[model samples]
Target chain A: MTGLPEPLRSRLHPLDRTLDTLETPAVLIDADVADANLVRWQQRCDRAGVANRPHIKTHRSVAWALRQLELGAEGITVQTVGEAEIMADAGISDIFLTTNVLGEAKLARLGAVASRCSLSVVADSAEIVDAAAAAARAAGATITVLVECDTGGGRCGLADPAAIAALALRIAGSEGAKFGGLMTYPGAGKRLQTEQALQAAIAACRGTGLTVPAVSSGGSPDMWKDDGLEPLTEYRAGTYIYNDRALLSRGTATLDQCAMTVLATVVSRPTAGRAIIDAGSKALTSDLLGLDGYGLVLEHPDAVIYQLNEEHGLLDVSRCSAPPSVGDRVHVLPNHTCVVTNLFDRLFIVSGGRLQGALPVEARGRSI
Target chain B: MTGLPEPLRSRLHPLDRTLDTLETPAVLIDADVADANLVRWQQRCDRAGVANRPHIKTHRSVAWALRQLELGAEGITVQTVGEAEIMADAGISDIFLTTNVLGEAKLARLGAVASRCSLSVVADSAEIVDAAAAAARAAGATITVLVECDTGGGRCGLADPAAIAALALRIAGSEGAKFGGLMTYPGAGKRLQTEQALQAAIAACRGTGLTVPAVSSGGSPDMWKDDGLEPLTEYRAGTYIYNDRALLSRGTATLDQCAMTVLATVVSRPTAGRAIIDAGSKALTSDLLGLDGYGLVLEHPDAVIYQLNEEHGLLDVSRCSAPPSVGDRVHVLPNHTCVVTNLFDRLFIVSGGRLQGALPVEARGRSI
Candidate 1:
């Protein structure tokens, strides 16, 4: 075998100019939608006199975080030390870690990241505070520690206001550790509700006589109804940037404002009612049941993804007016945007059906 | 801060010694169990007089594939061009891509990979055959093309035998392509059924009037059955290396023989009956419903993972003998082994409570 010819290139036909031509199960992020979504949140926070610290955990891309900063975000919130490290490397100065820092190894890594930037993390227990303090001192870094309040999230944070204040005092008393303020993630169920509960929680924090200079409280679902944010100086809303099916269900963002989507191809039309796609658990992510399916078929909303294999995405096309053919590509908006972002290595940023830039999910698999 | 401290070395404890201390929702692959599983499959194939071509899609590790080859596997099988490329780079000689090769980019990639090894692929349609032939010619290499028959999989392959034979003839006539044999995946439903049905399907391939050099058939669920392999010269089986909940449910492998497990920590015991862990969709993977939960609690079988958040795994420990306390680590056998393997970047091979070697999931997240 000598003098080999060049391989065939996929001709960019006229029909391929549309979104339908791209490969199936590919992630799509509409920049316009994301931009509008970012602006809307910025406007809401501006009107409420609260700072917007959009969480980078939703996208895990420095480019997306920079876009948020460009749209008037004060800072950004990251969940892990790895995420903070990546963002700090990309020149993101302010970062708030919402999870508890545990273990000496993780705390040391967190301390190194905190030393590089204006990093602050939450401490729910005294043990976690001591660990953080030791790591911060060892690194010769002054790290801000936030007293995470359990505002019904039931995941982390102290339940009692006095306990939160005590943890804050413990961090303040420790060398190389400074008390930041209070932080809380109102459970998903209460995120869309009125701010009556959140206001009460803030009042309770004030009742403890602790100077809660910066109270961070915000979720995508109820960011619009944040009228009583006089207590919360900064709002950490992540999902508002790329609203998902959950946000849609909560009436937070319209379907068009959803920035991210999975582009999939109809690989098999097995039965009259069912068609199988190339996207499955490995692509779409098996994160559903409360919602109708894993995601909504953008062009064919009537079609439902009933079953999913590792490689085969089973779609029920019986309800559709026009079923997808053997080689038709479909767009899917995943139920959870954050989980979907972790599944891919890169994201294709397209505008007007043209390839713009390929953004890497810098913190794709930083689960630790 | 006058002097910055040196970067702390990663104190990542060995998996074997740290099994008791390692965080729960962790993945553990017992080398002993894996070796036994591999030897069992090898014995099954040897007794059936069929060459064992273990699919590396299950493990996606060269070390695991090499172990299978050492146990008497003829070669390896892959599903994607990316996966084939990884295996070829790892010095695997023979390979069979069991999926339809399509488009210019993928075909080109497949052709480049085919040139490096004894590569072949399955085709169900004329379009796929043309694409493969074009790629092979462009790469100045020949690739053996197998006509895929839809014995009942209903995902890919031609349903009719005449159509399969016709596609086989087309490949035989095409330049840079050779007609190999017939390939069919009998779907997951026929996996645990009697061997008579599989035997008939293998026998039906003989009547195609084409020289059947190989007849590949075998799934992890039915690896024990050998009567079906009488007419087949080769067996393609994956997932026996790491048995999962699905295989255990089908009585294919016992719990003791299952190699892979997820180690997780109980992060929140919010209520008396409900406990939440750190490993959720991001770690454990949400691939359940038909089986038990997403995974089986190795220590607490009675506990049920009722709900899974993006970062939290909610386990209902109401029926357990003793509920695990907060920070207690536990092992979970994922519902599906293949998807779990894709979730992690590295796997620590443990033997007798000691570290052996770390295997990188080289072809992980290579969905495209």
Candidate 2:
């Protein structure tokens, strides 16, 4: 389908130059560079002898996931049954749900997805395994279940290795559930300033075999710092495709390497130090990740978005050498990329001031 | 049409008791109570001799907008042309674009919407007025333009009455644009902690000889202190339907009056004081409104959400009288109500624990 509406077919007005002209608080992706980022990550995983299972939670675009597969990714990882359903409908064959499947509603959906694709999911409890087994049996399909272990993210996982093994054993013995392996996020280990912590996490995962064949440890920040990965068979990284402000702050990628940004315009200059942009919390979102302000201004890095209302972003320009006038377009790198991507229905792809095709955020509201 | 698929219906395990089995990180709305809240707001405007133009930006749902009209709302207020188009397509005849419509693409969309609906939009500049006029003429439509005056919000609007008059004149003389009266947000003035300050803003607007036909003023925190409504011919309030943590902090609504809450589950018990919930930046959002954390635990107000990752919310339960154990379900009132509504595709309507129906967030990502 043609992405651009007929009215927006002509080259956008010069006032809307760059991605900024598209409107304030609209998602902009540098298509040429984002594609390059995807290819680079796939190559890195291929060289490391690890399966490149790209996570779809970052961009939530079926088009992007297909591109990842075309660039040589083994499969795609989704966090929810709703997301997996979207990807499955888009013709993705191999899918991995990295989140725990709870309740009967989700398990039935999971079983349906398993029938359509090479499906695998993580489970932390025996009850969840039993539910998955019953749903898979009812659907006449078998699903691969991985035991999720707490590798220090402190989020969702089995607290101890014995608990993880017990869950894996339950899945193996279940009627329609097959034990795949173990999955660990190691979220804190990924964002470490040095590689020593990540190495330690790999060692810990290696020590806890419990008859598990494949060990999954993944995050984008340490994508390049892959040490002690000989014990792991697969790596899942989402943000490597579109490095954001938070990842950039951790020294993962440079500003130019960051592919996604919110293009916004100065709509109101109400005060000398303060100017309101068209994009507010609804557009840019309010995900402040221990950063100084809301986001980083691409044009005026010195300008700080001190506050954000529902439909207005307040840019503090007191420290700037020259204030941005009204109608000026500015690119803001959001603190958290995933949440911001979910806020927009489509993303405009641009390269060297040329507007590429638009891609829909297909899984934009798959919260369930 | 039924929102859920037929195959998924049998898997739905009805709550053991009414409202007892809801998992955390889920959105719950009391259908009967929410309907009452809508009726109450409509009644307030009916008695005050003002047009009740409810803002749909809060819920972003066509079903909810229709319900508001059924409850006697004259029209609806939207923040973007994209939203206006969605509402117009959904059979909402009247709409007010509450934000500045800039650029040719947005102005063109606005013009198209104006042709189909009783559409009006706010502008802070003569340039924007001309753009709107050009687009409206091309689309063979006429639009009423309101001069957005900066009261104390410092977001969008002209501070000077003369400048406002000039912009109004520009719209009045334009080919397809007509001058409507003035509009102001009164955002900063809402938290004045006294009724006298809010009255001062109304007096300032009346001081101008612009006739002041439609003096629209609203903010849920000061909705009850409507002493300033003597001059307001219309009111645009959004949050009175679903009170949030911010409104509760300002003493606008009690916990029971809060019709919306996020049901979340404790996914991980990493430590004693720290428990991770399935809801994170993706589910609850990261809107910390000058509070200690992102949201308030409805069941355990003392349990503070200290940190949030993409798919994990960290709860600091050290101060709680009784800490939430793993697998416990909790309800969280988000800091901002509008944002939470935008995050979900469907809202579960519940009353005394029985599942009423699922309402789709039809206009969830309608940000142009």
lDDT of each: 0.74, 0.76
lDDT of 2 by residue, B8-50 (tens): 2322334432355444457887755666677788888898888
Q: Largest DockQ belongs to which candidate?
A: 2
Give the winner by lDDT: 2
Clashing pairs in 2: A16-A21, A24-A264, B18-B353, B19-B353, B24-B263, B24-B264, B24-B265, B25-B263, B25-B264, B26-B263
Q: Put down candidate 1 lDDT per residue, A1-368, tens digits, no spaces.
A: 01111110111112222453444457877766776788888898888788999988888887778778877889999877778888899898888887665544566788898788988887776766787788888888988988777677666566665666667778778998888888887776565332454455556656666566687876776777644455578898888878899888888788888988887776656467877777778888887737888788888889998887666778888999998876677888888888878878877666555655456788877766
| Model 2: per-residue Cα lDDT at residue B337 | 85
Going through the candidates in the order shown, the clash numbers are 14, 10
At residue B38, candidate 1 shows an lDDT of 85
Write down the TM-score of every candidate. Answer: 0.88, 0.87
On the 0 to 100 scale, the lDDT of residue A335 in model 1 is 87
